[model samples]
Target: MATTQSFFRIQTDANLQSMQVGSIMRKVKSRAWKKQRYFRLQDDCATIWYKSKKAGNAHSTCKLRWLWKPPLISISDVEAVREGHQSEVLLSIADEFPPDRCFTLVFRGRRGNLDLVAESAEEAQSWVKGMRKLIENLENMNERERLDQWISDWFKKADKNGDGRMNFKEVQDLLKMMNVDMNEHHALRLFTMADKSQSGTLEDDEFVLFYKMLTQREEVLRIFQDYSSDGQTLSCRDLEEFLREGQLKQDHVQQHSMELIEQYEPSDTAKMRQAMTIDGFQMYLLSPEGSIFNPAMLEQHQDMSQPLSHYFISSSHNTYLMGDQIRGHSSVEAYIRALKRGCRCVEVDCWDGPNGEPIVYHGHTFTSKILFKDVVTVVGNYSFKTSQYPVILSIENHCSVEQQRTMAQHLTRILGDKLLRNALEGKGSDLPSPEDLKGKILLKGKKIGGLERSLDGVVEDSLAAEVSDEDDAAEIEEENLHNDSIRRKPKKSKQGLSKELSDCVVYCKSVHFNSFKHSRIHSKFYEISSFAESKAKKHMKDAGAEFVHHNARQLTRIYPNGIRTDSSNFNPQEMWSAGCQIVALNFQTAGMEMDLNDGLFTQNGCCGYVLKPAFMRSVEKRFDPEHPEIRDGYRPVTLTIKVISGQQLPKVNLKEGSIVDPLVRVEIHGVPKDQARQETRHIDNNGFNPMWHETLTFTIHVPELALVRFVVEDYDKTTKNDFIGQYTLPFSCLQQGYRHIHLLSKDGTSIPPSSLFVHIRIKEGT
Candidate 1:
């Protein structure tokens, strides 16, 4: 009971207390599909337990709430609580309920958002307010406290019979769900030890005790003992040695050692004695400070005053599509997701819609449409939430002059001062820095004869112009090739540009890419060009150095080829190697290519802008990634990563006979010379504590640009391997020494209690 009590111990407020009473909320999936779901806050305050079926009405309560199994929304899993009619899903049911009566629970990763409507607005506010407070409280919890809460939640979930106790069979089932494939005899032995009452069914404290024993990390104990002289407590000197040798903390050895002792040492006596016990050592190892990523690099540490073209901006192509290119739904949710993830650049394909408004969707396709104003509103709301850097709205305009004027009006009205209408007062021919244009949105599209206007600041909407390139050139061609809905049509000529929309283009004016020499001679700093994947790759191979020089002055965007009907992403690393600033990828897709993009922008505060190397940024000097040795600062690095072990590896398949056979794959993504991968042998029938202790080595020719990806896969000789978890970071962002690489789920969200212990050694090669 005490063990379980610890899990439910949070300072309960009025909102949480009221929520415990439960409410009858209508779960809205679509306009036609709305059902009453009984929602109640679990006693732990960490979960919102709801039934899958309807609750009939508000008066009738769930008889046995705890026993109402599965599909409960864990608070930690929720990314944000979107209130009002904030999403397209909620907007569909706008007619049935008032705005304040509806809210959406946006989950992390690729999980579909849960849209709910309450009987009254007050009920909705209570749930939203309560859920938000819970999330905030969860963020402030220590690692140990979070683990305790998790244990309690699992106890509630695994107690299938609702007896507040787990029998041997139930405990076995819990183990399997926890990603543990343990031997029956061993499990029985531990279960017997924890049953101090000698009862066949174990209670709360007993379950907690059993969990501690089961998850005892022997490998960590071995490492701790290796550093501790007494095999118990690490003295100040001993701790300093560990920091210096293991963590590679050379300068602040004594200072850092004492700081860590005070931070992680739970015992007051141990802290006073300047010693660290086993528990404290474990706590330190699991903290974010002990992560593989360099702690100093976590914040916006890089120089942000550099020109926008000097950094690799995190750009997304077709930000409105949540699914395949042709028939995917176009919703405001896609815009929200991309902006919330620190995407600095997003593409908005606009066309004429009902009521003389502009709509965003994939042109010439069966894709649905949402109002352009809705997309702008979402972008403005979430633009600076994750990052304060400038957000470029790559406008793919296919609208009439009236609708185009409406698009510009929506941009200025919805985004307000955030929209950069006029250029910065002090800026020259060179593009402004991310710092200079912080919290602003820039338009990237075709304009009528550029930024030429009369002295009175009057612009004519009658001025018609043309741009040589269509932003969705490939997609439109493919749409024409296979337009079953419409007859096969000729290649559409370039559409006219609206002077009103063109006036909004402060920076990132889209233009056709002819050649590197022509761009260098004719292109202005604000004029940007887009290239298809094939053309970009050809340019990268042939005139790589020249492309690097061109990008140093002007912005170059690379998008996936039109033939990719499945909405797949191209490898952005090649374009990045040539210093292309905006290499847009399909943000909805996930793979090694997306992994590389995630890795590169993970640092520099994850501000969606990573500054290029000095060589690439320099005007006189250019770095041809094709010939790495010719670079000015060509300090090659030899990286050695010793894969010690994996902790709590998730089960790829939860079938009775299936246990994960896990393997680790370490890939280096950079210049051709630095790109390579090495993997370790797979372990059989173990999803828990699979030890490899194998080493993978690579010589990165350009460590500054290289990204290292650590992947764990469920190996299958019979079929293709299943992805388990992965973590990626820039090669230079690696913290030298023993560190834990916390794994991320497929859609780049943290999967807690899943990590790999590895020792790293990076040395200058040649």
Candidate 2:
């Protein structure tokens, strides 16, 4: 067990053997009602018990109400645990309890809250500390251990006979639980295969083997058959045909084919035969040295100690919504999903709620609302869960002063020291490095007096006078709320920030943009500004170099314009080209843009922080996005890829019994006109394993700025072709060999081991 400082004196009793810590009175469904329950924490789960009285003899009885386990009991599960008053300890569970009594633990199988009232503040602190320590320890367990525990728990649940083995019926139910739907005949065949002893049932070891078989794909054998001529082995002639037809240049085809054959058939006896067996074919495809995506790229480390402003941060726009901006439901799950996928920056639009709380949602829209406290709690729990780099909470505030105070209080209490309440190192002239702010949360929003005081502390008097004038204007606006004629007059602009919340603004203070020149003159290290995609593009077109130079010293965020009501995303590469660190996308929506974003950030350890290119980082170097000749640093190259064959290409839009005519389209996305391309040709009818001995080539002028995308689609003449799957990679990362390209869904998730076999070659000049 991991050691942690105890909040109170450790209680040692005979009951400790049963794992029972203590008992307390818990508020039930309503605050007025209370129930007494004893809780026990075990290695894998926590259990609750009830005290029973029989003939004046009191004893503790097991209450099989609910079980809290790892994965399910994530960091976000326990929302907040804080002292309500002197003896009352408030606890909040995410989306499990009633809104009126959210400060209670709602078990999975039970209703209402477990808002326990500890004997004293010290007791409450002890319970909270114990629970948090248990959760943290569970989270810190290695992946293999967690997987083993999960598998063991699942096996126990599915083993209905309690015989430590699973029969056919139980196996069927287990498959259903795993969300795998297989025909009865196929499932029985697999079961029999796994039961090597013919015992009519599967033990734990056999069950694990069966599970692997169910999920594993036969991509290698399928592709090997496609390349073999006699349905047994691939001869030298077969290899030559596969390579020559794959679009390899005539000058290079003969030499490359001979080299591959000699490499696979290394022995003199095998060389005399000039053939590659099944084992050799498998080795060539599965070997890291031959794979299209170099495994070494993932191991290559980059600098992680750069300043926060010197990196392009993976960010999300409207992080609370999962669908259409106007009517989408606001959910804490969105934040969890985004953070888990390496989103370092998240946006929250706060408004006043029905009670004294502040809620997050799209303002002035019909979207659903979630508590601001809930969002903050979720962020605090998940901020460093994926990446230890700092998380920026971009706030769009529209709350009144009272609710703003509630927001500040909840954030401070829930986030604790993780929240940056003040500038670090006494407010340096430059922003802190990512290394300095690791595991911290920075609040970014319009702050009252932030700009004035940040201006060398010399504008304090003028800012004070401006604040007085603003307060007078606010009083007049309040008076006009009662008069008809006065209300008809133009309303005064409301203050965007509250004094209480402003104190939390440390490094990232959102500011309004006036002009490029004006921003350069007034912007401070702590100040950041956002621009709509359209406005940012306009500025880039007008003063591209100036904007680039400005972003070198400070931070600028670019988001999709307001016209994207459907929650679509803009091409983030465009904004990234201009040195904008925070290129916020609608993470809820997935498309080519998201794919590109995923591909770019797939490097740098997917830590949600990638250092800018040297040219972009240097003020002296002039790297213009519009004109590449000014840099002249990139070289022209020809990318030749052959669409050889696909293994278990998923059915795309065809009926259950119908077959699909699969075709591969190769796309090259780059900055120059000659480099941007879409070329498609070959199609095959075999859905399980289709072979198309065709090659497509693209000549790219700027290989550094290019991306190679391979899309698999179902051919249809009547309507548009259906998307099956795709794989996109940076041009710089593409490996040249007989390689396998693993396919991913439109949402950028790996589609099992389904893959396409291709031979790629990159030549020096167009």
Candidate 3:
């Protein structure tokens, strides 16, 4: 029942006529009204309602086409847009203007041209007031220069991003800014005409071209005839008059208005470019200043702005040697302390010591008695008991292949799952080869392609295939037959893998040849490692196997998964780019201590950081504060407990059970041995990895314990023999119950005797 300009209450009963209004209303679901459009209204006399400001123009009225359809533009948008119009228009719109929520306007000029324009009823009323203001401003602005300044200001309002030229999106945003109701597609078409390149960007010249095009398309010239005060200077109010006259019509003015607004939107390519600038890959190369494709650099430093999966600190210099102190004071403990302070990784070279131990020495001969086991122990002590991944303890094995295997076994026995413990385990079928470690937890440090065997000399390929192919249904019968046959000649084997073979083996494993994706391993290695791959391919498990690039520079092409990295040197940025899962912090790549201000201990790959004691100490000093409860509480607390496994326990399960596992024992270290011992409670029997037993839970009795320090020992309970692998947890305790007291003598003397016992040289007798 509502009519267009329904508020006008036309006195004439002009029969209703059909008006062809386009679908200009916004989609119901669009919250921002970005998809809204305009519609027109007409009557039986073709005497359409047109908005005009010719002195005493009368408001016109028309009927609705559909029975229940309401006004095209809502009242809110009309009021919002009108409010943004100049202050003078507000007063005029409030006066004599008849208001309604929906309406359409039609205008005719001397050229016999009819233009149809539509606005919400509220907008129709607002338009009359705005038109009146435009006429008044044109009349008042006697100076053309003032008018020009106003037009420039209006133009700037439409140009967003402050680039001085309106693009399609900018125009759409401008409409939204002013709350003018319009649809997106129509807005796009309107602005594209001045976007001469069709690139969706509008330059000042293009915008000017659009302005001239608008001047030609509408009957706006008469409205602005008196725009210039001195015949040379046109006021902005005159420009508003021109725009208003062109816009309020039944002609092609709406299309022209849309074209003008299209110039405000930015092109798709510009948006894509903006997205690229904010991405991780581009940010990574921003500081190095050139393509990072160099093939020979062992290590390269990256700037801080790069987007990394994890945060890290870089070494001060690219190729600094580590632990070169002349005295016998060099220790992995010192290196770890520095690492804990903040460095993510540290590197060290390994050579065979006199006892065949892998020691920290770059030279062919290992001079320092410190072994690789010592290094792993220090690192595991620092990182275990935290959610952080294992810290990288990269060992550059410069010794013979046999010695490399020895080093690997030693490291594996030391770190458990708490360190990137890489070692070539064995040469025969009984052990894991360096290559097989790719899809698995064990890291192989040497060359690939050779098959490693277990101590029993049984080939791993046959065993793996047998294990994979064996049917679970044949369990009882097979176990009986196998036990009868193997009782006479039992064998045990272990093998090791190198970084290259590991990568190839990992890639070839767990993939189907008939699938779309092919493994990226070199074809030659694929043919050679086909046996392991065949068994792995058949069964969907490839444990800790992962691909590792032979060189660091090859990381330019890899996407973001299934890889680990090891090299003589480490570049956190380059390694992360290459999709390396872990970056080995070798002591030789850079010293643990460089610039105190620079955070050298943080990791770029994962949350794990590997460090020697010295490095860990520095990190602790810098990041961890002293216990506020204690006088000088900021110092990092160190707690060490030694657990002995393989010990037998008496059985009685209580809700608060005290039964100890028969297989383990504890040795508290670093803290006052007695205090650490006092804190030891329950013993747990779980392994970190399903295959290996590494961590155990014990209760702490003291509320003030800060850090835990101790050696853990596990023994063969039945035989009472010492378990091979031992570890320590250091500086991982929070200071909750710690308290300090001044020890005083009976006479109130400040200093007490070094020994608790009083030296009773008691003059004769007490």
Per residue, candidate 3 scores C-alpha lDDT tens digits across 568-622 of 2222322322123233333322211121111222222212322222211221232
List residue ranges in candidate 3 displaced over 4 A.
1-329, 342-348, 364-369, 385-387, 416-444, 447-766
Cα lDDT tens digits for candidate 2, 1-766: 1111121112242333333455444444334445544444433343233452223224534544433333233221343343342111232331333233223342221111246654444555555665555455444643233434445555766899788788999988775554344578999999999998789998867876776576443555565677778977778777677665533335566666667667655356656687776655554554444557666565536677766777889999999997887678777767877887889999988877997889998765678888898899889988987788899999876676678779889989999999988777644687887778899999987565653353322222223222222123333444534543322332333544456677778888776667878876877877787887877888778877777777787888888765466889887777776788999998878788888778777766778887776667775665666765567466678888877777656666434345567788887765534445554554545455667768888887656656677888888888988888888877777877578887888777655345788888899988
lDDT at 744, model 3: 21
Q: Tell me the TM-score of model 3.
A: 0.22
- Which model scores highest in lDDT? 1
Count of backbone clashes, every candidate in sequence: 0, 0, 160
Candidate 1 matches the true fold with a TM-score of 0.94
Each prediction's TM-score versus the true structure: 0.94, 0.64, 0.22
Model 1, CA-based lDDT:
0.84
- Of 2 and 3, the candidate ranking higher by lDDT: 2
> Every model's Cα RMSD, please?
3.2, 11.4, 34.5
lDDT of candidate 1 over 673-749, digit per residue (tens): 88899999999877788999999888889888899999999999999999999999998789888899999888998
| Residue 344 shift from truth in candidate 3, angstroms | 5.3
Give the C-alpha miss distance for residue 471 in model 1, angstroms: 4.3
